[model samples]
Every structure is written in structure tokens, then in C-alpha cells.
Target: MPSHEGEDEAWLPPEIAVTVDLVILTLRASVFQVLLIERGEPPFQGSWALPGGFLRDAEEDIYDAALRELYEETGLEAGNLHMEQLAAYGTPGRDPRRRIVSVAYLTIAPELPEPVAGTDAASAFWTPVEQVLDHQVSLAFDHHDIVSDAVERARDKLERTPLATAFVGKSFTITDLQRVYEAVWGVSLDPRNFYRKVQGATGFIVPAGSERRTTAGRPARLYRAGTARTLHPPLTRPTPSAAPEEAR
Candidate 1:
């Protein structure tokens, strides 16, 4: 047999660690907020980051790890949240401590109570998303980018999906739904136009056979989220016009 030693050599795989990061978003007091945890361990200890952690072992599922981390950091249990995979990030030097490949998860939760930190988190709390995107709050690792991506994802979902209903209670008025759009999209919508648009989106919402009294106006009809998870006549997001080119 001719020189088979080299061909028979065993192959070695790179040592890469897997982790899950959650971008839990919710609206509070008409402001968009994201959940962030202060790291309690080294490498980024004392720094704010998206709540997450390394995989427990080789056998644990990626999504299960995400759910576990969410619970650990927020005290919010499984089934109570509807998390969707946002994206995966594996850029070199993303994590300083090791070679980390993170799978990001996203969720739009209703108004939640203050979170109690667990696992390796020093403290967990909700902060305005604008603060992180605007650099008001410092983030560790590659979390700032993750937060930005999640925010855009949420904004997009509001246009294509009936995700805004997730931010409210069992029943809500048209104004309640409109406020969610205004807060997340960061724009004011004309009430008459908004009403017409939502009404056109068949199955987006349905009458709940109830009304809520307002301080200044007539009782607003309360509607419950419909069975449809998507909008037929989708809500469209506004796009800014391009700036005119300056004269040469």
C-alpha cells in the first residue's frame, strides 16, 4: 500500500461555543422597551447585554436553551412567551472570552413586571430601546447590533403580521392598537386613516362585544385579536424620501 498514512489522518473540528441571546421587547407607557441584563461574570461583567448564555451541553436544543435563558433572566416561564428566532451571528471576535456563535431570539411581550435577575446576570430590567440604539446605554459583546436588528424585525412584523396585538391585553380598542403602532414605528398616524386601514385588514381583529369608557370621548368599542396571525391588507410602514443631492 502506497503512502496511505497521510490520507488516513483523523480530521479535527474547530472548538466553537454556542449561545442564545434574547431580545425581549415590550411597550411600556407608550415607549418601546427591550430587556437587558447586567453581566455578573468576567469578560463583560458589570456590562449590559442581551439576556443569554452558553449551551448546557452537546445534546440540548438551541431553542430550548433560549427558553431556559429567558426564564432564568426574566423569571418568565415557557409557554407564556412566543419567541421566534431572529438570526444567528458567528463573526470572529464577537465574543472576547471565546469563539462564540450566538443564535438570537426575539419576542414582543405584553407589559411585564420588573424582572428578577438569575443565572449569571447581576440585574435584569427593561430599558427604552431608543437608549440602546442611540448609545445612551452601553452594551457588551455584539449586543448593540443584535438589538438594532431585533428592533427592525419588530417594525417589519408590525406591517406584515398581527404582532401588535401581543402588546395589549385580551381585549383592546382601536386607539389601543394604534398606540402600539405609533410607539414602535415612532410616528403618529391619523386616527381616521388608521381605523380605515385596520378595518380593511380582514381577520386582524374582531368585535369583543364590549366597550371601554374614556375620560373625554364616547366609550370605545373593545375588540379581541382574531384567529388570523397575519394581516390580509397589511399595514404599510412609512419610508423616508431620499435627500436631494447637493450641487457639485
Candidate 2:
């Protein structure tokens, strides 16, 4: 056997931290919004960022940690909301303290209640997506890039997935669902064409039994989310060149 070289030397593993951040998307009063938290600690103290934190322990599952952080900071449970991994952000120097890689998630929910800050968050609230994407509000760390990716992910998903249904209440009208697309896509949709496309998507929306909308318009039949999670033909959008900056 060959003589052993530096095998006796002690090896110290790099101290890399893992965290999860949530981009909770919802429609509040016809506007598309995302959940945000104000940090209370140093390294961008008092800055607004997505609600999230480091994994509680090595044994903790990433998804479970995300749910825990969501509840801890916002007091809102995931509970049937659509959540999926968005991406991983591992840019050196992104965090002032140490090397950190963050796993971002996009959570789609409908009309979530007001957030009450807790844990390490100084305050929590629903902020319109445009405010952040349009550079109105500054964020901590690399959260702006994270938010941009999450929003584009949402818009892309809206074209193929019925996740848009997750942005409305349990019961809503065709018009109600249309607004979700309009707000998220940042484009106006023709109501008639939207209704036709929705109707053609099998199992996309089932009529609510004996449920009638009681709003300003003429009596309209209510609908409950259906079994399908996608549109077969899928809704279409304008090309990036033809669309407004918001749409792109």
C-alpha cells in the first residue's frame, strides 16, 4: 500500500447556510400583491424582504421549514395554497455575514388576510407586485432579483397552469377569475374570449350548485375551482416585443 499523505490533518467543512424565501402571490382588491417582511436585524436592518429564514435544523425538511417560516412571520398557514420551488440564489457577498444560498418558492393564494409580523420580522404586509418590480421599494440583499424571477415564473405559469384559480376566493365568477390573469399578466383580456377559453378548458371551473353572485352585475352563476390543474390549449399572451414593459 502507498504511504498515506495528509490524511491525518483535520478538515473543517465550509460554513454554508441554507435558507428558504417565499413569494406569496395573491389578488387583493383587484391588484396583484406579494407578501413582504421588514427585517429587524443588522446587515440591511429595517429593509423589506421576502418572508423566510434559515432551516431550523439539519433534520428539518426544506418544504416544512418554508411552511414554518411562513406561519411564524405572517401568521398565515399554507393550507391548500399552491406552493412550488422557484429557484436557488447563491451569489457570493449577497449576505454580509456569511456564505448563504437561498431556495425561493412561489406560493399562490387567494385574498389572504392582513399579516401580523412576528419572529424576526418587524412588520409584515401585502405589497403590490408592481411597486417592487417597478423599483418603487428597495429590498434587502438580492431579494429584488428573487422577486423578479418569481414574478416571471408566475406569469409563465399563468399561460399553462390553472394556478391562476388559486388567486381568487373559493367561490368566484368568470370575471373574477379573468381579473387574476389580467393583474398577473399585466394585460387586459377580452371578457368574451376569456370566458370562451375558460369554458373550453375541461374540468377547469365547475358551476357552484345554487350559488348566485350578489354583486353589482346582473345575476351570474358562481363557480368553484375544478379538478383540472392546467388548460389544455392554454391561454395566450402577446409577444415580449408587442407587450408593455409590465407585461414583459
**Of the candidates shown, which would achieve the greatest lDDT relative to the real structure?**
1
The regions of model 2 sitting more than 4 angstroms off are: 1-13, 215-217, 240-248
How does candidate 1 fare on TM-score?
0.91
The runs of at least 3 residues in candidate 1 whose Cα sits more than 4 Å from the true structure, single-residue gaps closed, are: 1-8, 240-248
TM-score of each: 0.91, 0.90
Best by TM-score: 1
What lDDT is obtained when candidate 1 is compared to the true structure? 0.87
Write the residue-wise lDDT of candidate 1 on 1-248 in tens digits: 44544577865668999999999998888889999888899988899998898899999999999888887777777666557999999999998877899999997778888988877888999999999999999899989999999999999999999899988888999989999998898777778878999999989999999999989878999999888888988998765431111100
Report lDDT (CA) for all predictions.
0.87, 0.86
lDDT (10s digit) by residue, model 2, range 37-136: 8998877889999989999899999999999987776666778688889998999999988999999988888888898886788889999999999989
